[model samples]
Target: VGHTIESTVLALESIAATDNIAKNLGIEAGETIYYVKRIRYIDGKILCLEESYYRQSIVPYLNREIVEQSIFEYLETALQLNIGFSDMYMHVGKLSAESARHLGLTEGDPGLTIETVFHLTNGRPFDYSVITYHYEHSQFVVQANGLYL
Candidate 1:
């Protein structure tokens, strides 16, 4: 759980930095990109979600600073939780249409898939990914892509 939290933080930071660089290079509109991080707990397990958006342009003064600040606030809140999990159950990268179908995600739904890469100081780095499809705007169907370490 600790490793997951740490990796999540690093991943978000990297995304924020990348967004800044992209903005400076004019690859993405500075006001159109934003980062979102969400955390949930179920059955004594913690699940973290992070994504970088480039199409939503509904905010004023949208920049890397605002994005990083929001992430920092989220981490501050998550660090207060006590999670009890020794081993993870799912992790992987990329999602194809077939994979989504097998995972029960409908074809027409708006969904977000995350590919998480983790580097540890004493162990091999790994990629963890998840796909979430939402229906009815109330619930999401989740699928894990690879083995959890």
Candidate 2:
């Protein structure tokens, strides 16, 4: 038996980059970039809100149909980009009013926020994203391999 997982793309647009986003993506402020917002559900229950920004110079094109499928697959198979690694941060936070509404919770409800910056094999940052997970439904597992003293 397994739980069903689903994702809905809420917004997908091209917009001028902000300073912070520009810095994260190694692009200039006001450069065109693709922004995508989506929500993930498990077992028919909303679980997380995800927002991502991609460099237009690298990604070039995107559409609702493509985004609803898999951006990673397009980047790898079509663009031939090598996804190398990411830097991530996680923290406890209160959901914003918009996030709460999408998650079926009240504003200020507890949530887990994860921020990540993804890089290419050449160490160029191409995507930055933030994901907010519903506190009641979120679970995380980490596996470590190392020598313990």
Candidate 3:
């Protein structure tokens, strides 16, 4: 949580077809969607690989420049969309061949998987993502804070 890092875009484009299960939530089948993927690194060491799909119709102004920088920035500012809430689910998994390749690990290596769902201000699901964390290198801790009146 306190490290300088760099990001690299692995792929970013609009796809008319998607296999994402969240499509059924609102987006129509065969509808266009923005598929964004990137790798996060600290001092050149890969930390995680994140891949997300956004409903194009909901965030249609996205461009390559925005993708290379920050999609959330564009989503919140340029698009003027509010992120109502999000849900995260985490689990341990065996790294898939593709995920392993992206993280520079051998197949069958340990991986931490997290799936996230984001809802917009209108209460419509707008984004869904799957992130793979390098189990050997990742250090994640959650803290709890409560405010009382």
| Candidate number with greatest TM-score | 2
User: What range of 10 consecutive residues in model 2 has the weakest lDDT sum?
Assistant: 140-149
Ranking by TM-score: 2, 3, 1
Tell me the alpha-carbon RMSD of every candidate. Answer: 16.4, 2.3, 3.4
**Residues 12-130 of candidate 2: C-alpha lDDT, one tens digit per residue:** 99999999999899999999999999998888888789999999888999999888767899899999999999999898888889989988899998988999999999999999999
Whichever of 1 and 3 has more TM-score, that candidate is 3
For model 2, the stretches where C-alpha displacement exceeds 4 angstroms are: 1-3, 145-149
Better of 2 and 3 by lDDT: 2
Residue pairs in collision within model 2: none
**Tens-digit lDDT string for candidate 1 (36-95):** 443322332333334433222222123444443443343235433222212223433444
* Model 1 accuracy (lDDT, Cα): 0.35
- Across residues 1-149, which tens digit of lDDT does each residue of candidate 3 receive? 57766678888887764555445337767788888889988766898999888887787766667776667777888888998977789989798899999999999999999998889877888888888998777787775687655
TM-score of each: 0.24, 0.90, 0.83
Arrange candidates, best lDDT first: 2, 3, 1
- Itemize residue pairs with steric clashes in candidate 1: 91-146, 92-128, 92-129
Worst 10-residue lDDT window, candidate 3: 16-25
lDDT value for model 3: 0.80
